[model samples]
Target chain A: MTRIAVSLLYAGALVVLIALPQLISVKYYLHLSILALIWLIVSQGQNLIQGYTGYVSIVGAGFMGIGAYSTTLMGMHLGLPVWLTILLAPPMTAVFALIVGYPSLRMKGHYFAIVTLAFNLVIFIVLLNFTELTQGEAGITGIPKPAGWLEALNFRDREVYYYFVLAVAVLTTGIAWAIVRSRVGQILMAIRQNEDLVGALGVAAWKYKLFAFVASAMFAGLGGALYAHYQSFINPEVFGVAQSLDAILAVIVGGSGTLAGPMIGAFIVIFLPEYLRFADSFRLIIYGLLLVLATIFMPRGIVGLAQDLGARIAGRR
Target chain B: MIEILQQIVNGIAIGGVYVLIALGLTTVFGILGIAHFAHGSVSMFGGYLTFFLVAGQGIPLVIAIPVALTAGVVLGMAIELLAYRPVRKASHINAFIVALGLTMMVEGLNLEFFGHEQVVIPTSFDRVFNIGGVTLPELRLYVILAAALLIAAMTIFVERTKTGQAIRAVAENRDAAILMGVNVRTIPLVVFAMSTALGVAAGIMVGALFAIAPGIGEGLVIKGFAVLILGGLGSIPGAIVGGIVLGITESLAAGFVSSAYKDVIAFLVMIFVLLFRPQGLLGKAS
Candidate 1:
């Protein structure tokens, strides 16, 4: 993305985050927008790990669950403020990822995915069975919101939480962009294509892979923490197999390995199902068909297709 | 002793279904290197069709099974031609996405065609056979026998037939097979048809033994893939052994350990196997 595109995106984001809520009187749409932003943040994290790094981490929902549960538990038990707990969730997930990723990431591509998936399933099982800590499937309720300056804005408002999530989304994007544009991104991409070649070049490719895993885990954690506060109630179902597939689905649909792909993916994933409600019974059928056609024809996804169109139009000028 | 024997019997019965599913997966992955995420869903399609034939249309079990298997063959071929053939030379990810999409599409289709209820293929084999103080349900016995027969048949066909040789050649080296005048185009369809037929058979067995539902295939496919990995990605015998081991392991785990965490234990076993031999139980070390 160019500077102009970046500036325009930021401006547009600012309008949608700050101004659009005021413009749109419908409360549900604002709520949906916030949900999309949270998913976008998570997918951006997924993009970093799976798309750029080329290691299809399937435990994104696992990380998200960990983040949500940890933040919620700490808040409920330890009396930590929502803001502090949310801030603490990502790093906590990162530490967990270090242990999980260590044994799993050492394996090859698809094997790594299975391990992560197994871990995801295991985590869900733990959350369900370790009932005392997570409250099991009944879920944790009565979670507090961020009680800071936002409180003055009547943080009980969904719009305020939306803005908070939007800010986090922007921060997530900036961090991912910075990491990808630098030497770090190139090294990770290289590792994705052929880790052996990068290792031959003395890149210590394992470190980069681990970094991507941890960073992405943290990103998922942020999304989860925000989600916990936003929803005010969460359960083990949030980290389900379907949700695990959701992160990958969003990344792929929005054009994996692109800066804005995950955001676009988040948009489609969060809102598309809602929009498809019009299709009624055939909603999933259409969604599935669209997904198949999109990937088969446009492997680069919607963003990549847009880039192609943009390049064509720009070249004419 | 009877419980252990019965567990083994139960394990083999389910293992038979896993073998069929994993065999389908292993064949596709072996030949084309595509994960064929839709394989499970496709198998579900077979199961659903069998249910429709047996229950809805009132077709008898003996006749419906073959018809379902044939339909599976046709569907498999169509999937190869339309879904996979175009992207043969594209990046592996494209095909992977196609597989994922196919999975969702098939799942959606299953839901549309069959309502959100589980269906069992009604069979006459409801009797229980007892031997040496162990009891075997007639349905489970047939399932085990059918799976064994199918595995044997598949092994023979792959080993003996000229076409099987061609498929093997393609699997070993596609370019080399092409150079050797093997019609590479036809092989994928054949492989798919055969693989899918096996999957349909497995679906039929699962439907009869347990129940066929929407997400059942997904769970079955996940187990199939685990078997694929446990046995060895491309090895047929590995798939067979892996399927049985996984089935038994899951059965034992459920019996002895927590029933809810059986899937987790099964996967943990796979992970442990990976630690020892990542290439798989039967795969040659990389």
Candidate 2:
């Protein structure tokens, strides 16, 4: 059956990812893979909301920043283990989402988009101006890595962190797949198709929207927590609208409405620029042109394009 | 009182810039229902172009401006035809994607062409005039007058011209306008052209008044959107009033509260306004 083939493919991918750093042996590639995995975590959360629930939350980077700061500051100043801080940070980040989502979710479509953008702006402003706490844009450097048994895993090694991130990526994707297959996914997809119909069917659209928003906030937070520890520094700029745009670009380029989209998107978003290091200064020009061309010519994204191609070949047989 | 008056004067100049941005944005959103996020980058492109013509090529401001304005019109038309026309009947998200992509493309172009340095268009309007207690610089005065003149011109054109009437007709009801013999297809082109022209005018003012560099367009576009919401989406007069209100609010907030969070305060004020009037200040309550 196709299901068996798909699971086998998934296992194969997992094995390949686990062996990626070992095969490549290049530290730069390992670093890039780690970055892609981090983005994958955030984009999956972004996919859940923007892709499935059909609300474009542009504030994912802001929540990610919140998580980064929470874990970093807590681990550094409070002397708590980085693991516990990461564990607690996501829930704390979600609390902020609850506050913002209640008011912002009242607006529909693009209005919500702008409101979330404003929230991100607000976070950026606070991060920069709250000099006493956030270090006033100089950024917190030398953030301690995970300690105790987590550090015993030798995360200081680039290869070890790669596996660590891969595990998280797999877990995150698994949870996303599980959710997408459940009744909740059906309701979310229905809302995307027609919120009025969902509401008419007695599904309170707001509650479901809030739930997805909170779930996404947690994902962003987790990604941020891991990123801060891995990168060993944090800054307000990392949480700006540009970072959120990168998430959007990945989701759209990979295919927004599919589970497979964000994973593929993370690779393109991170690697295309890396591959085009020859373009040097003009890298973003090609990047921008690609964004416009892809959106226009293949609005369905790469995953959707692949699906169409596969269907055609299968039908030919 | 003098400080308050001074702040108001300062706010009005920047407000004039906001009004121009909102006018361009409102035109596209009003008629086409596209957010046109690239309008800001296009506006910045206008600034960079004028700067190049004047500063780099050693051309006069008078000559450079018209050339930039014309280029803006052409670029605006190209955007409609190339980027937006194909996805006209598709989902709104398609246009949204186009807008996002166009913003990046244009921003990328700006960076590649203009580099990362902030350029201030050199102007000789250095005379400072002190009236009563408040001091008014020659540059700010010219900026305000220029904004007023442009607004008046846009109003007259939209109110009196036949093309303008057709544009308005399309916005009011597209199918009805088509039945009434109005060429609906050309309206987007005209709207984008006029909108980009207005944005160019704003960009020129901004370059002259402050400076222009990479990423500034993003902030301007956000403010323009805020003005759109504050004034009422698709309402020209609303854009005007909302822009002025936002500009003044930003000025006052910076002067009294904290200049560090000046941008945040503006959006916060907008949120406060929306809390009470969800349709925006001049928006029609549905």
Candidate 3:
């Protein structure tokens, strides 16, 4: 059956991912893969809100910053274990999301997008100016990776961290898959289709929206925490509006409204730049043009395009 | 009292710039219902162009201003025809996505052409007039005057001209406007042209008053949107009042409160407006 073939393909892809670090000789590519995986986590969360719920929250990077800072600060000040700090990041990020989401979720469409962008700027500003805590633009260096677990496997190696991130990415993707398949996901999609109608049908639409927003923020937080420990450095620069735009780009380019889209998008947004070092200066221009052209010509993204092609070939047979 | 007056004067100049940016945004949002997020980046493009003309190419400031304005108009038209027009009938989100893409493209183009370092447009108006303990620089005075003149011109165009009335008609009811023999196709172009021109003027003012750098456009555009929300989405008068209020609030906040969090205060004010009066100050409750 086609279902069996699809599952086999999924299994094959997982196998390749697990073997990627070993297969590639260059340690740098492993670093890039880890980054791509991190982005995958963030974009999956973005997909829940933007792709499924039909709300474009532009503060993905900001929430990531919150998660990153929470883990770092707790370790620095409270002397908590790195593992515990990372675990606490999601709940901390979710609390901030609730505060932001409650007031912002009232507005629909462009209003919501703009409000979230403003919040992103607010986050960036605080990180930049709150020098006593965040160290401003200089950022916190020497962040400890989660150690003391599985002593045989060194966490310092890029390959070890790669597997760790891949596991988290897979788990989060599975969670996203579950959410999309559940009854709650149906209502979220309904809210996307026609929120007013959902409310008219006596559904508490705002609650669903808040849930999506907070859930998305938690994903960003987890991604940020991992990024911090993996890189062993934390800075506000990486967690600005630009990175949030990258999250949006990942979802849109990879295929919004599709489970596989963010994974594909995460790689493209991260690796495309790495390969385009030749056109260093024109990179952003080209990157932007690609986004515009892709949105206009291939709005459904690569996954959707593949689906259409598959249907056509199957029909021909 | 003198310090307050000084702060108000300082705020007014920047506020004038905000008003122009918001005016440009409101016209497009009002008529086409597109957020046109690229307005700010494109405005920065104008500023960069003017800086190149005056500082790099040795052109006169007077000549450079008009040249940049013309380029903005042409660019605006091209944007509508090429980028936005294709996605016009798609879901509203598609247009916004296109707008976001356009913003990045324009921003990237600005960086590639202008380089990363900040540039201030050279102006010879160096005289400062002290009026009862509140000093007003000659450059700031000219900026305020130019902004006032431009705003007045925009008001007249929107209020009195036939094309303006057509624009208003389309904004009020697109299907009705089409039935009434208004050329809906041309309206978006005109609105973009006028809006871009207004934005270019703001950009030039900003370049002269402060400096035009890579990230400044994004900040300006966000403020412009805040003004849009504060004034009321799609309300012209609301943009004006909202721009002024935001500018003054920022000035006072910086002067009295922590200057570091001035931008935060502006956003907070915007959030406050959204919470209490989502319709905006002059906007009708929908």
Question: For each predicted model, how many residue pairs clash, with residues at least 3 apart or on different chains?
Answer: 0, 0, 0
Off by over 4 Å in 3: none
Docking verdict class for candidate 2: medium
- By DockQ, the best candidate is 3
What's the true lDDT of residue B270 in model 1? 87
Poorest lDDT segment (10 consecutive residues) of candidate 3 chain B: B88-97
Worst lDDT run of 10 residues, candidate 2 chain A, spans: A144-153
Against the native complex, each candidate's DockQ, computed on alpha carbons, is 0.58, 0.64, 0.76
Question: Every prediction's TM-score for the first chain?
Answer: 0.95, 0.96, 0.98
Write candidate 1's Cα lDDT for B177-198 as tens digits. Answer: 9999999989999999999999
* Interface Cα RMSD in Å, per prediction: 1.7, 1.4, 1.1
lDDT of 3 by residue, B1-286 (tens): 9988888898888889999999999999888778888999999999999999999999999899999999988998899999988888766677887888899889889988899999999999999999999999999999989888999999999999999999999999999999999999999999999999999999999999999999899889999998988898888889889998998889988988989999999899999888988777777887
The number of clashing residue pairs in model 2 is 0
Model 1: lDDT equals 0.87
Per-residue CA lDDT of candidate 2, range A86-154, in tens?
899899899999998887887777667887888899999899999899996899999877753664588
lDDT of 3 at A250: 92
